[model samples]
Target chain A: MALDRKIAYINLSTGEIRKGDIPLEWRKKFIGGRGLDAYLLYTNNPPGIDAFDPENRVLISAGIVVGALASASARTHIMSKSPLTNFLGSANMGGWFAPEMRWAGFDHLVISGKAEKPVYLWIHNGEIEIRDAKNIWGENIYDTQTILRQELNDNEIQTLCIGPAGENLVRFANVMTGRKNAGGRTGMGAVLGSKNLKAVVCRGTMDIKIKYPEEALKYNEELINQIISSKVSQTMQRWGTMFIYGTTNSTGLVRTRNFQLNQLVGGSDIECENLDKVSIGLDGCFGCQVHCRHRYVIKDGPYAGTYAQGPEYTSQGAFGAEVGCNNMNTILVGNHLVNSYGLDTLETGSMMAWAMELYEKGILTDRDTDGLRLEWGDDEAVLELIKKIATREGIGDILADGPLRAAKKIGKGSETYLVHVKGMSNLHSDERPTPSLALGIATASRGSDHLRSRPAIDLYNLPVQVLEKVYRQPDGYDGPLTSGYTKYEGKPRIVLWQELCYMAVDCTGMCKYHTVFLSPNHPNFPEFAKMIYYNTGLEFTPKEIWDIANRCYTIERLFNIREGLTRKDDWLVDRYFDEPTKRGLPVAYNKKMDRKKFKAMIDEYYSLHKWDNDGVPTPELLKDLDIADLYPEESRQERKGK
Target chain B: MKIKKVMEGARDGEIRCLACFTRFRPKRGVDRAACPSCGVQWRISWPYPKTARLQGPVWETYPKPGEPIAKK
Candidate 1:
């Protein structure tokens, strides 16, 4: 029989370490990885504390099936109070780190307090040591990892660290591993930097036994075949998500020039096919068969000889469509810059695009940007802005604190031009034409993020029968439904169901690409049930798994609610209602999201979750989920002391 | 727009119909897959290895620069 991994409590101020096993009851209720991390976060803090406070914690964990032979089960979920949102800062990344963490014999680490000096954690084969890391503290992300591997004298060591962006407390800094796998949203790296922690280096050879190896192998083979058989997966393997440009840009689903247009005309220069000229090969996370990441090198022109992995579809929007630059080199160089500096590529692009919009409207003068004209298609300026934001120099310093704060600093109704939800900027897609996607980003737990609950398949024009079969079960939605991507009909039901599906997927550490992010027939609850039962001998029926996901999502809601976010926070920018999409085919063109119907949808979604119209989880719902004691004793005491 | 075909795991020869999701291998030198379910014509472009990437749900409706294609 396989044994469970323990959680380590490390206090940096006192340098005290305590270790204990996660309660089996919590595992049954919340599962592991992101779900358990969210639970721990809610119970640890009293709410409304500064994200940079020494008492704020940084929780890192491997999912329940991580390091198992299962494919794509290697997401490392990082959670902290977001300096960006000040509401539930949580992020996940795909890499080799979590599997190594699992082998190091700890499922989770709850890090607290600030260090007196810069340090890093060395965890190996069930033991941990806080070592002085002054040598690598201010290094860029790649060089920091390189230094750690060199210092440890082992190439096999995996490192998760921040760069100068994080060290400078940039609000959207990424905590990254490898060249590209980033815990990319919500500035969790800044949280680590605030504690004077540079990195966590791990090398593990501990045994992780499988309870039912033969059954697991057979089932995993079937699962892998199911994933690889999809046409979307095949496209992913070929062009990465850059293949999405073929549909999104052509159909005007993309955001161009900071939401002024739906698509960029004559921007085919940055197309995925063009990138093949520089392509070396495919790269991917541990044990993933999809191989959906591109490894490319710039071999000519301005960025000659620069090599890196990726410039995902998000990068296309960031540097290409959104900021109005149509050059591939911009993406290549911009991707390299953000990856090295540990900045979130999406947020960097959003800030640049927003600033361009401000400049276009004359709300921002040349003096505000320090005489550097913020113009569309100025690829040089976009690349320069990325560095400035990371290093907190001039205008970069203004955007480094993120859109909401930067808007307040810039004033003159800059907030109205900002595209964000819960103070975090939305992705590069213009969701004005797609109500389902709009609803997902509007109410995402981590603030305008796509990975949380995006139904990427919704715009596939999937047959109504297919949509009904996929989304209308697991608590069967009988509301009005349609196949039209632009319709506001029955979207709340679909969005709610997808929320649970993605929550469970994160809990099990499966990539959304392997699940229902694409394809109507992809794996769901019953598949997760067999996965848990076969691998860990945890017997959960499909319904039980759904209930577990419900519990996990509700806990995240409790955390954000305690942090003072209300139903109004679960809403989109006014642009969705005010401006119609200016490009794409007839189905997408001139379409604006219906405000009244959207509000009604929100009400319906809250009712479905058994919450009041305000989107907070009800007491009855919390009690039903077995997390009735939502806060800890310390939280109550903190409020009393206040 | 031209596409070069190469052998990859999922793109050996077969292409899936965007409308019906019915997958069928083409005859020698056949360049398209007409859906038997919805009677929609899908242009096949084997642009890269590992993907016989379908152009769109309705490829004929693919635009001609800053304008949606005129479609019935």
Candidate 2:
């Protein structure tokens, strides 16, 4: 079967739509979606281009595995030069959008140039149109989706749209699919808004073709069964990521009150039981049986009668623990507000926590808050401020730029309170003793995030005796009790390995949840490679997959470096280094990282990657990865020598 | 003189002398022989006591039906 390999490129200047077929060899080499998009971005690279420049292109691509016999949670990648990071930004999202795009007979959509007027792209099978969207241009995400559905007179169409936050060009604005699903990192929504594009409505009836249909069906069925029976899947199904709330809080790693404390006194109150009281049922994307998506109804509050699909683990932690507000109703309302208004929950929550701290310290007063008191537990005020942030009103106007930018604007000792690594707000997880996870966050391409590389299981499973034996420093000898959580020796190596593995998973359009289902202990790692091989007829071992992932990571790193990212950009907030948790017993407490030691570890990682000390790719490495022609020879040679 | 001879013979013979009612014939393929009058069974005189391996549930052991037997 000849699979549809067409990619649509829209030139905003002429409003000309060009449809081209991707070469068969390129498709085989790069796979599809993320890898292919990265290859395309590198080819279109222009020197000294700003992220918001008209020349900067945004490519939304669906994976080859999508819209076929793929498992649930197949993701779509939204790739562009990040307005926030000014580097190659690839944000992955899960919803019905990717499959819809595939069914429309297009592998990907490549958009460039700025539209002269407000417009939306209507993709109906092979026909494409740039329709006027002036009526819905400044609307919130919810209204835009509703209006677009009504305008098309087809409610079944999957829409990816932006809200006023994006229209106003909030640096952390997210591209929202439906009310609950968003491509929420790297400011891709801002890029869309800059193009004067309102939404992309995709609908089609084309069928996906698969190789070895019988074999693929059998493998998929077996894989689904394994996932449903896995321990982690059971926990996810039962609690929807809230199972970790109690564990994270107990372990003293749940970020609380702008990361000043690791453990919140009322953190345990946000567990599954509490959430279950308000939850209606479960929601999931197409083909997902393990519905980890939670649906909730707020019974009573200032923001009552509001229903939403989540306050997922991170969002719950962000709004509840981080702000010192343990009200489940408040978190639910916050979730609904952020989703409907189309804003990044982590960024909004982190900014609120920072503002609250500043207010308590008397650095920010009623004058700055526009008569609203910014208290630690002021749920009502926080919700209102979130609205403002979405609409860029009052204090929200200052905060819509994110904590890092907001801190720079409100300077006197406030920068210390802004917890971020890169311009992105840190996901609410303390990285005190789990230095490997912390290292992963610090070195993440997008920003301080947990999803980029999760090391929770690694930290949980490592024997305490093994850790104590590894890091035998006398000065930090707090006791055996601290061994489980402490950042001791051999952590950097673990972080580097996990990050590379996660990158591969991200590129493959596979759900990380399946990893737990298929094999808790290296669960079906080889089977996944086999599935890919059988489907694509491409011979790949597990080691080859790892190599491809490493190459992708290097390509992203090179992009960042060229965009002016340096070693200075790879460090966490000062509070994490300086402060000890006030509630915890003194066990490896007040631990600070030595810059020299961290640098040495980074150098070791670079050497392991066959890159230079400066974190650039060598010629030999790039050639091996099939990306040698992308970079100038002199730059590659310089990296090789280092 | 007869009683004294019987008693002396009973003590000497491995099977018993038939002169007294207490004396009995030795039973073949049986460990013990029964006395017809007293209803008591006694073993014939032997060099050592014959031992038999018991094949049933052990004392204080819980029994499960249909368990496989181990070959010794």
Candidate 3:
């Protein structure tokens, strides 16, 4: 079957549809999904546009590789001007929705303008219609999904819906897909709400074109087998990502009590062994073999018989350790509640943790919390707060803006307890001991995150110097590369290399956990790359792949710099600098991060990239990437002025 | 009789073995042969003083499922 590339453009004001074929050159260079979204956002100059502006477009693009013979694990990217950072923001999510979009004969859907009334888009095999969503506008995410499925009379038709939080335009509202998978950053759901779009329901039967089915099938099968055999995969398969809970806690990187402490008293309660007690079976994305996703049931609690798809390691730490709640049942129920309501677990957990700290210190009381005592380790209180946050009821209204904004509103030394870096809450990963990882967290564009860089693996497994040397070496090193598991000197370089590699994985529509580090071990990556080449006819050597990755990463950095981001914005929380763990702990918390040394490292990083002192892309560098025309003129003035 | 002999050898200096369960010990060498009962190989660097050990059960112990285990 021939695949037609259909681009769906919705005008919010007129309810008119504009359909066009994806440009041939655009598809060739950008591929699809994240790559295409990045190209489109860059071309549109969505950066610096007010996130709520009608002109600000949110494009949901599915990769060309998705719904094909290739791994259907390919994602859908939500690209928009972020209300959270007021800069370029894109968050990708994996579920049935992306494949359904492909089956609907669309490569991407570009949504622009604001609808005058609440509405939902229904696309079934190329026919599109916008229906009034007045009845389901204020529903929770679960209810909205249920109602949409009933209304469409198709339970299998995958839906992406926003909750009351999104409908209320909460700055951190996440676009929830499937049951628990979410594009959970930069408030893409709020942008959807701004357009008065309640949900996107897609169902279709069209087959995606495959260039080489036999080779693709062979490569995919081999890849799955290799994953099943890997030791890391075995561990993940057993306990999902929660397998790392005990190890991360032992490594002193688990975010605890709102990043105040590196250790938790109840850390053992949520360990892999303990999680196995509550978990029923493994859950995974469509066509995923790793099955790292998990489903857990809370058999006993104030909220009993609650089952959730995940309280994945991040959620576990955020709800369990960060808030000082040790109860597995609480974490499970909390995960179910948040996932059902379609709230970002990271934000909900971090904000609730922050609230608990304020309550503990008597900064917040029953009066502030509307008669509910917010105490640390109180699972009941935590559950109440999660519900409130979702419904924007009581204390939830205050926390809907997230920790930084909530702290500002509730200021009376409340800001001191807030543990965000650059307006985004710290993820479950703590960055106290590993300075390289700390720097990565501090410098992450979307805020404090583990995914932007993979320095955590080094902290957990390798020494610093060896990681650095390996990074300094090119894509494929033949020398005695440092064991990434051992601590050595040259770590910053390794982190930089990993960051570039991650950029490629994200753009190419591959799962990072499976593709990047394990590539060397797997026999299928080379064949997988060959499959891409066969499909797109873009022959890319591994070196060329790295170059493309570097180009994408540099462009992302340039995008931020255009919006006036500086090295000063790249910084960790004060707790990392000042707090010291009690004696006998692995965390050497009292040691102050040498700002001068970190600045020197940044200088080295800039020089290594041939960028200017202020981290702007040089004219020569842009020309080398053949993206000279893509560099905005305003950025040129900003770079020249700097 | 063979198991007893192996245990006796492990306890005596003739064996020069470390506790195989905790591999961090011995501080130097390791025995090529594993324990007959546990299949754990003892490191050679550790001095096995005959009178110094055996206060508890020899097998590895862990918390059973749903049982509350002591925190690390």
Candidate 4:
């Protein structure tokens, strides 16, 4: 019944490795993976610790349910203090890495301190070795993996590594696994780079013991059956993230031309059909039946023979709509290039769009751009810019720092063009039209990310009955469409439920797309309980699991509070609230956010979390969640005052 | 420059846009086609499925509504 997962702490400065069981209490409170990792970061890295400091620990945890003989149990949680946002640095990646780590007899790895020289950790059968990565120091992510596997004589080893972008300390650099799956947000790779660590290669032969194997198998079959049967899952399997591009584009919510416009006028033609030309096959993470990741090849184009993993909706929106490039081939190339160089595609695309805006406005020119025209939809320039940013060459150097810092450095009123929340670049979906999405991103802990708490169902325009079925409410609200701007009644409730569910999904190591994030037919609380019970042998009713997820959410809120985040910091870019999204006569046409309505919604959202007027968790609520140890009552009051 | 128009009642099939080089399906009779990316308007003969754009199919073996979900 003991999960028997252990945490390995690696001190790079002293080259020491310490292994111990993760505290059972911590597991009981935070669940596993992201929840525990967040707690560890908050406990180990104190306030004002420099993100690049040796003391800034990067915590990695295989999800509690990962390797539990369930579907898609391949998720890993990577967290550290972000060099980019300087707030909560956390990212979830799906690959074979997490299961490999678990099978290697450890559930978590807390890497700290700077290595005296470039090194990669080799983990096998609960044993750890710090091997010199001197030869592979400057290699790209793909090359590093290949060379490490060759050097270690294990082609089957799973590797989590950084590339030239990480080594050079690009602020938006990410840690990549396989050739494509990246822990792609919040500059975790830069943290790895700052420590002189290159990679963590794992191979193990140990078995992941699960309770009630028969029941688990049955439930997993049922879950997969439900998932693959759903229309949403099937569409996802076919088009990957491309299935929704048409919807986003047609709705005028997709970002275009640095958000100078909302919709791409003729974007449907490019998005609807172009991807079919390149996708060779579909791929998935560990144990997933619904393989949603696209494996693509540019069979015949200027960028021919380019094979890569994905241009997820994020990349497509960034390259296609945000930068005004309708060419899907460029997105494939950009995805491949960024993956090789270990760059966060969303941030890279945002920075590219930012520079293009500056160019179009005459603020930056060919001279500043190193003679490369930084124009919208200039596919050649976008590709070149990706390389330059990764290598930190010319304007790429300025952009390598991400938009917030890059804006300050390249100030000709450049800050005005930045589409960011809390110093991180916004996701491609323009929130000006969707109040729930706007509020979700503004209050999201990791900054401008929808994965935290997006009410995607709100965009479906489903009827009141479907909304009631999905959201568990029947009377108060009509539907998502009817509950648009100025409708605060049901929006706050949906955001709250989604935030908790999302936090729980991440903690349990499930894909958001497979959960209620996308569709009502997907798994929810009851199914989650069955999965957890069969895997960990820990019985939790749906409500109990939700409470634990709430605790995890509060702990993250405290982590941000300790770093001085407040209600004011929760505001979005002025453009969302001010500028009317100008595009076509699409649904989101001329839609501008009403700031007061947004604040009122936030006020209600804060109340839903039992937090105070300024959005700080109340001391009583912290006690109820049993996380009063995180902040004493007076300290909570002090933070609230701030 | 004004785009040249094809006369109505032309043959039905696929036609490639000479301006943008993107292949697209045209309706029967004299069809006005516009390149989605470039907005270059063109007059073309009606084209059928054979001349459809080289885009990925949306539903690639995915279960349709009312179809049983894959058991595997």
Q: What share of the true interface contacts does candidate 1 keep?
A: 0.13
Q: Model 4 chain A — which ten-residue stretch has the worst lDDT?
A: A473-482
lDDT string, candidate 2, A2-47, tens digits:
3565899888868999998877776556667777777777667674
Q: On residues A1-642, what C-alpha lDDT tens digit does candidate 3 reach at each position?
A: 333758888877789998888886665455567666766666665556778888888888776667665543557778877776676677877777887877877878888888899999998888789899998998877789888889888888888888877887777788888778888877788889888999988899877666666666776666666555454555566666775664455434567877666656435566655666777887777666667777777789665676568767877876788888887777788888777776778878888888988888999889999999887788888898988887788888889877677888898999887777677787876666566677677766566666766655554344435444445434554323344332333555656666766665565555665654532333223544565665555566656656666666676676677677776677766676677543112233333455566676566566656577767777788887667887767768865687
The better-scoring model by DockQ among 2 and 4 is: 4
Sorted by lDDT (best first), the order is: 1, 4, 2, 3
TM-score of 3: 0.85
lDDT of 1 by residue, A305-372 (tens): 88788878889888899999989988899998999999999999999999999999999988888888
- DockQ comparisons of all candidates to the true complex: 0.16, 0.01, 0.04, 0.03
Q: Work out the TM-score per prediction.
A: 0.92, 0.83, 0.85, 0.88
Candidate 4 residue A467 Cα shift, in angstroms, is 2.4
Q: Write the per-residue lDDT of candidate 3 for residues B1-72, one digit (tens) a residue.
A: 011112132323232112222212222233334434334332122212221211111112321222332222
Q: Residue A80: error of model 1 in Å?
A: 0.9
Task: Show model 3 residue runs off by greater than 4 Å.
Answer: A1-4, A45-47, A463-488, A517-528, A583-592, A632-634, A638-642, B1-72
> On DockQ, who's better, 1 or 2?
1
